[model samples]
Target: MLKAERHAYLLQQLSKQGRLSAIDEAERLGISEDTLRRDLRELDMAGALQRVHGGAIPRPPVPASYADRRGDDRTRKVSLARVAASLVRDGQVFFLDGGTTALCIAESLPVNLRATVITNAPPIAAALIDHPGIDVYLAGGAVAKRSAVTVGTEATDFLRRFRADLGFIGVCALAADAGLTIPFAEEASTKRVMIEQARRVVALAGSDKLDIAYPYVVAPTTAITDLVTDHTATEERLAPYRLRGITIHRQR
Candidate 1:
């Protein structure tokens, strides 16, 4: 496989199993141990993995700044964003949680569709400026410098004033056991409000986010009505979600 493809495979393995066996990954890829080592070294240098003797372990995922996360899963986020946008209809008021993928939804919105977007992310509100049909509302609060999002009590309280038809939330990690989660406590708190206030909630995540867990819990697994992810995810990896009756939409 190509380097990019191998990198995705390696990370996906880390997401699922949390560590790698050099022998197993090498055999799985049908590549020599030397080539696998080189690949692991490259990924380590890129801050994608932590290399160790004989194998690799999941690099302690320190959530990067929004700018960094925005570029990391561009393809998968864009694909998932497209699917999320498809769920919106004109004249609907929706809640958009802050993140790179949520920004993608704003940018992917249809040209002729008219809707109202209420968000804690200034970046996402700014992205909709050119979309003539959409109305944007910005919730006021302390802005998170790294994520360019509103947080704190002001933002959460402001969000409580409006009820939305749909809520498109971005998560740092997702697992059958952990449900939806993020590293930021304030962000997780805001998301819980969004979930309770929205009529239908959709959580958008890249395939790599599956089976991962973060520091704070946003909500339980049953809180979300649907999940949208990239087709890169295997059915085997998605079985748990399906069994839970959470409708899964895989972007092609």
Candidate 2:
């Protein structure tokens, strides 16, 4: 088949099945595996699909700006925030990532809860400022105005200076095999450090963000100790994360 014909077939299959196995599809198409892989690569670059270890999946939806995301999934984000807040403990050092969901988590924390929160998002830090018992440390770096968060090499280097008891990451895209991913490389750098330096890493993602892939990978799904998602997530959707030994925390 011509390359365009092959690309169309691959895309059609991905849309119907939600995933593709490189080996199996190559055999079906009567083509060498290397040729198939090349096609997948080009498709990925074009933003038509996301290439995983052995196959491909759909590309994730484009994320909204920081301001817009804050209002996108208000109820679901609040529900997820409450559950995530319950996991925090007194005196624990926390790495709170930047994003609308993380801001909600900061707001949901108990007023009297005593803990140290290290964050790169100005909004999250601002939300915690008046919490008498919580100590907030904002990371220093060049701010990415669209996301309203601090990012860059400086932020990642600063995060390496301290280890935290728990790290809460705002996930852009998550898949069982492709792991945690985002579109921006700088933010991915900071999040990778948060995953590495924390004793436990919890990914805060809504159900809509699952089963998709983004351009920049943060860490493998195994790096996450827990996942906090909304109630709409089905057991079928979460089973792969469970198999990876990631404890699931759903909104009640």
Candidate 3:
């Protein structure tokens, strides 16, 4: 068969079965394994599908802006933040990721809470100012206009200074195999540093982010200690991560 025919077949099979194995597909297409891998890699780079450990999974198509996201899911964000806040204990240091969800998490902290917060977002730093007992540290860097979060070599360099007790991560996408991903490479770089420096990491995501894959890979699902989500998530949607030992904390 021609390459176009093979591509069509691959997409059709993935649409029917949800995932595809290169070994099986190569045999079915009567193609060599190396050529099959090249095709799959091309497809992956073209954003057609996600190449996993041993197969490919359908990649589905973010919150576009900071203000829009902050205002988008007000109630659900609050609920997710409450779950994130519950994980915080007195005197523990935190690394807060930038986004509406992290803003919600920052806002949800107890007013009398005593803790140290280190973040890369200016707005997140500003939001935490009213918490009487919490000390906020803003990582210095040139801020990105789109997300209003600090990004660049400077930001990641600053984040490396402290080893946080807990890290609050927010993402545009989350998948069982692709892990946590976002669209911006700069943001992804900063998030990787946050995940590396934290002793424990808690991911705050909406149910809409689940089972989805974004372009830039931040960290693997294994990096998260706990996942705080809203009521929209189902057990089936969460089972893959749970099976891999990542704890899921849905809305109570």
Tens digits of lDDT, candidate 1, 177-239: 667878778677788888999999998877667766666788988888899988877887778
lDDT of 2 at 125: 93
- lDDT at 170, model 1: 84
Candidate 2 residue lDDT tens string, 1-252: 999999999999887666788999999999999999999999999989988889888888877888888898688889899999999999999999999989999999998799999999999999998999998889899998778889988888888988999999999989999889898887888899899999999999888788898778889999999999988788867888999999999998
Deviating ranges (above 4 Å) for candidate 1? 1-60
lDDT of 1 at 78: 82
Name the better of 2 and 3 by lDDT.
2
Which model, 2 or 3, shows the larger TM-score? 2
Clashing pairs in 3: none
State model 3's lDDT: 0.85
**Model 3 — TM-score against the truth?**
0.79
User: Candidate 2: where is the Cα deviation over 4 Å?
Assistant: 1-48
Best by TM-score: 2
RMSD of 2: 3.4
